[model samples]
Target chain A: MSHTTKEKSKLLARIRRLKGQMEAVERALEAEMPCGDILNLVASVRGAVNGLMGELIEDHIRMHVVDPGTETDSERAKGAADLIDVVRMYLK
Target chain B: MSHTTKEKSKLLARIRRLKGQMEAVERALEAEMPCGDILNLVASVRGAVNGLMGELIEDHIRMHVVDPGTETDSERAKGAADLIDVVRMYLK
Candidate 1:
C-alpha cells in the first residue's frame, strides 16, 4: 500500500473533525445564534480547513518539489523553504 | 507582510489554474462530451485539487507539528517524516 493508504485513517479523522466543525456552524445557524457567535463558528471551520490544507501542501513540496533529505542545491532549498513558510502563513 | 501575503500572487495563480481546470470539466459536460472524456476531465480536476491540498497540508505540519529545522528529537522527527510521506502518498 502507498503511504497515503496506510495513513488514510488518520487523514480521514482530520477530515471528519473538519466536517464536525462545519456541522457545528450549521447548527449554530439553525438555532439562530447571534451574528457574532455564528461568525466565530464559521471562522473556526475555515481555520480547521486551512490547517488541513496546509499539512497536505507541505508534504507535496517535500516529496515532489524538494525533499530536504536529498536536495543539494542551496538556492532551490531556500526557495522551497520560503514557499512552505508562505503557505503556512497563508493558511493561518 | 506575512509570507502568505507576500506569496499571494503565486498562490493565486495556482488557484486560478485549478479554477480553469474545473471550468474545463464543466464545459466538457455542457458540450455533451462522451462519458469517458468527461470522466477524464473530472479526474484531472480531482488530481489538481489533490495536489493543491497536499501542498497546503504538508506546510501545516511543518509549521505547527514539527518544523524540520528546529526539531531535535529523533523520534518526533521520524514521526513527522512518516506522516509527510503518507500525506504525499495519499494525495497522489
Candidate 2:
C-alpha cells in the first residue's frame, strides 16, 4: 500500500479544509471586501497549503527516501537531506 | 476601489483552477496512487496557489504600495521592494 493510503483520512481532512478556504475567498470577493482583508485570507490559505505540502514531503522522505531515525547508510541519509533541501527551495 | 475588485474575473479564474486542482488531489488519494504521483499533484496545486498569491501581491504593490512606474518617492519604492521580499520569503 502507498504511504498516502495509510494517511488517507488525515490527508482528506486537509483537502476538505482547503476547499472551505477557497469557498471563503469566493465569499470575500462576492462581498467586495477590502484588498488588505482579502490578502490576509489568501495568505492564510497559502500557509495551509504549504503546511499540507510539508506533511506529504516529510512522509515521502520517510517512506521512500530514508527514515533518518533508523537509517544507518550515510550516503542515503545525505541524499535524503539533499532531497529535502531541494523540496524546500522548490516549495518556497 | 480595491485592486482585486478590478482584477476579479482573473483572480476568480485562478481560484477556480485551484479548486479543480484540489479535487484532483482528492481523486488521486482516493484512487490510492503512489506517493510520488500524489506529491506531484500537490506540487502543482502549490504552484497554482503561489501564482495566485504573486498576482495579488503584485497588484497590492502597484495599487496600495507604489506604482513603481510613476512613483518618485524613493522611500516608498524601497518599502515596496522590502515588502515584496518579505512576502516571497513568507510564501516560500
Candidate 3:
C-alpha cells in the first residue's frame, strides 16, 4: 500500500479545504472586494497549499527516498536531503 | 478602481483552473494512484496557486504599497520590497 493510500482520508480533507478556499476567492472576487483583502485571501490559500505539499513531500521522502529512522545509508540520507531542498525550491 | 477589479477575470480564470487541478487530486486519490503521481499533481496545483498569489501580491504592492513607475518615495519602495520578501518567505 502506498503511503498516500494510507493517508488518503487526511490528504483528501486538505484538498477539500483547499477547494473551499478557492470558492471563497471566487465569492470575494464576485463581491468586488478590495485588492488588499483579495491578496490576503490568496495568501491564505497559498499557505494551505504549501502545507499540503510539505506533507506529501515528507511522506514521499520517508517512504520512497529513505526512512531515516531505520535506514543507516548515509548516501541515501544525503540524497534525500538534497531532494528535499530541491522540492522546497520548486515549491517556493 | 482596484487593480484586482481590472484583473478580475484573469484571476478568476486562474482560480477555476486551480479548482480543476484540485479535483484531479481528489480523483487520483480515489483511484489509488501512486504517491509519486499524486505528488506531481499536488505540485502543479501548488504552482498554480503560487502564480495566483504572485499576481495578487504584485497588484496589491503596486496599488497599495508603491507603484514603482509613478511613485518617487524611496522609503515606500524599500518598504514594498521588504514586504515582498516577507510575502515570499511566508508563501514558501
Candidate 4:
C-alpha cells in the first residue's frame, strides 16, 4: 500500500487545514484588508502548506528511500542521509 | 523575502517537472496503458510532488522555524528540533 493510503486520514486533515488557511487568505483579499495584513495572512497559508509538504516528503522518504527504523543497508542509509543533508542545506 | 520567492526559478523548475509527470500520467490514461503501468506513472508523479513538498518544507523551516546556521537561541533551536523530530516520526 502507498504511504499516502496508509496515512490518508491524517493527510486529509492537514490538507483541510491548508484549505481553510487558503480560504482565510481569500477572504482577507475580498474584504480589502490592508496589504500588510493580507501579506501576513498569505504567509501563514504558505507556512501551513510547507508543513503539509514536509510531512508528505518525510513519508515519501520513509516509504521509497529508506525506513529509518529497519534500514540496515549502509549504502541506502547513506543515501537517505545525503538527501536529508541536501534538504537541510537547500532549506538554509 | 519569502523563501519561495528567493528560490523562484528553482521551484518553478521542479513544478515544471511535476507538471510533466502529471501530463505523462494523463497521457498514459488516454492511451489505455495497462493499469499497473498507469499506477506506476501516478506513483512517479506522487514522488515528484513529494520531492517538491520536501524542499518547500525545508525552506519554510529555515525561514521561519530556525536557521540552522545562525540559530543562537537555544529555546528556538529546541523548538525546531522538536518539530523536525515530529516530522520524522510522522513521516515514518
Candidate 5:
C-alpha cells in the first residue's frame, strides 16, 4: 500500500496513540485499578480498534469490489472472497 | 464481489471449521486440561486466527493496490492510507 507522506505520518501517529492506549490498559491491570474502570478503558480501546478495522475494510472493498481495473478473473474472484471472509470474521 | 457457488461454499466451510477449532479450545479449557495443554491449545488458536488475518490482508492489498479501477482520486488515496494503517497496526 502506498500513501502520501502526510497520510502515512498521520497513520503512524494513530498507531503510536493506540500503543499508548494498550499500555494504559496494562498499567491499569497491574495497578489493580477497579475492574469496572479497567474494563471500561478496554472497551474504549476495542472500539477504537474496530473503528480502524471498519475504515480499512471499507476502503479495501471500495477499491476491489467497486473498481477492480482490468484484473484477471481469478483476482476479481479473490477480492470477492476476501470481502466475504473479512465480513464474516470481523462482523461476527 | 462475487464468486462461483462452489467457491463460496468452500470458504464458508473453512469458516465453520475455524469456528469448531475455537470451540475446541473453549472445551479444552473447561475440561480441566493440564495448564500446559490448555495454553498450547490457546496458542494454536491464536496462530490460526493470525493465519486467517494474513490471508485476508494479502487478498485485500493485492486487489486494491494492484488493480484498483478508475476510482476517484480520494478513493485511491484512501485505499493507500488504509493499507498503511493496517500494516502499521498488525505488523507492529
Candidate 6:
C-alpha cells in the first residue's frame, strides 16, 4: 500500500459504486421499464452522483488549486481556469 | 499542461461546474423558489455531477487500480477494497 492515499484516492471508489448505479439505470431503461420509475431512478442517481462530484472538486481545491504546495500561483490559476473550461464543455 | 491530464484530471473540471449548480440550488431554496423548480434544478445537477464521478472512477481504474504500472497486485486490490468501503460510507 502506498500509504499516500489522499481524498483523491477515496474519490476513485466513489466513482466505481456510482458506475454500478449508472449501469443499472441503463439496464432498467434497456429492459423497457416504466418511464416514471426509470426517471425516478435517474433523479436519485443524479443526487448521489453530484454529491460525489462536490466532494471531489472540493478536494481538488484543497489538494491543488488552493494548496501552497502547487508551486506557481499563476499556473494554479490557469489550471483552475482550464478546469472551468472543461466543466462548461461537459455540462453543455 | 502537465502533459498528464488523464480522465481523472478532466473530472476535476467536471466537479467545479457541478459545484456552481449546487450553489444555485441552495440559493433557490433560500429564495423560496417553488419546490418543483428547485427539485428539477437539483435533479439536473445530480446527473451532471454523477457523470463526472463516473469518468473519474473509470480513470482511476485505468491509472491506479487496474494499471500495470501499479506494481503490486495485492496492493491494488486493497486499494480497490478501501475505495469500495469509503464509497459505501459516502453513499449512505
The global C-alpha lDDT for each of the candidates, from Candidate 1 onward, is 0.72, 0.85, 0.83, 0.58, 0.62, 0.51
lDDT for model 4, on a 0 to 1 scale?
A: 0.58
Give model 6's docking category: incorrect
Per candidate, native contacts kept equal: 0.00, 0.60, 0.75, 0.00, 0.08, 0.07
lDDT of 1 at A57: 63
Count clashing residue pairs in model 6. 1
- Expressed as tens digits, the lDDT of each residue in A1-92 for candidate 1 is 34345568988999999889888988988999899999898888887877887777666656544555566766446656765776676554
lDDT of 1: 0.72
Q: Is the docking of candidate 3 incorrect, acceptable, medium or high quality?
A: medium
lDDT of 6 by residue, A9-92 (tens): 353455455555656655654555544454456556676755654544544444544543454787776766666556545533
Q: For model 6, how does the per-residue alpha-carbon lDDT over B1-92 read when each residue is reduced to its tens digit?
A: 11114332343344445556656655654555544454466567665744544444444444544543454687776766666556545532
Error of 5 at A35 (Å): 3.7
lDDT of 6 at B62: 48
Model 2: fraction of native contacts: 0.60
Question: Model 3, range B1-92, lDDT digits (tens) per residue?
Answer: 88878888988888898899999999999899999999899888888877677667777787866875577888877777777777777644
Off by over 4 Å in 3: A72-92, B69-92
i-RMS, each model, one decimal: 10.1, 0.9, 1.1, 8.9, 4.2, 16.7
Rank order (by lDDT, best first): 2, 3, 1, 5, 4, 6
TM-score of each predicted structure versus truth: 0.46, 0.79, 0.75, 0.47, 0.42, 0.34
**Per-candidate interface DockQ score:** 0.03, 0.62, 0.61, 0.04, 0.14, 0.04
Between prediction 4 and prediction 5, the one with superior TM-score is: 4
Candidate 5 local lDDT, B1-92, one digit each (tens)? 43333246756776787898889888987897899988887787777767666554544554434333443556554554555455446532
Please give the TM-score of chain B in predicted model 4.
0.83
Give the TM-score, chain B only, in order for the candidates.
0.80, 0.78, 0.75, 0.83, 0.59, 0.56
Q: What is the TM-score of chain A alone in each candidate?
A: 0.78, 0.78, 0.78, 0.83, 0.59, 0.57
By TM-score, the better pick of 2 and 3 is 2
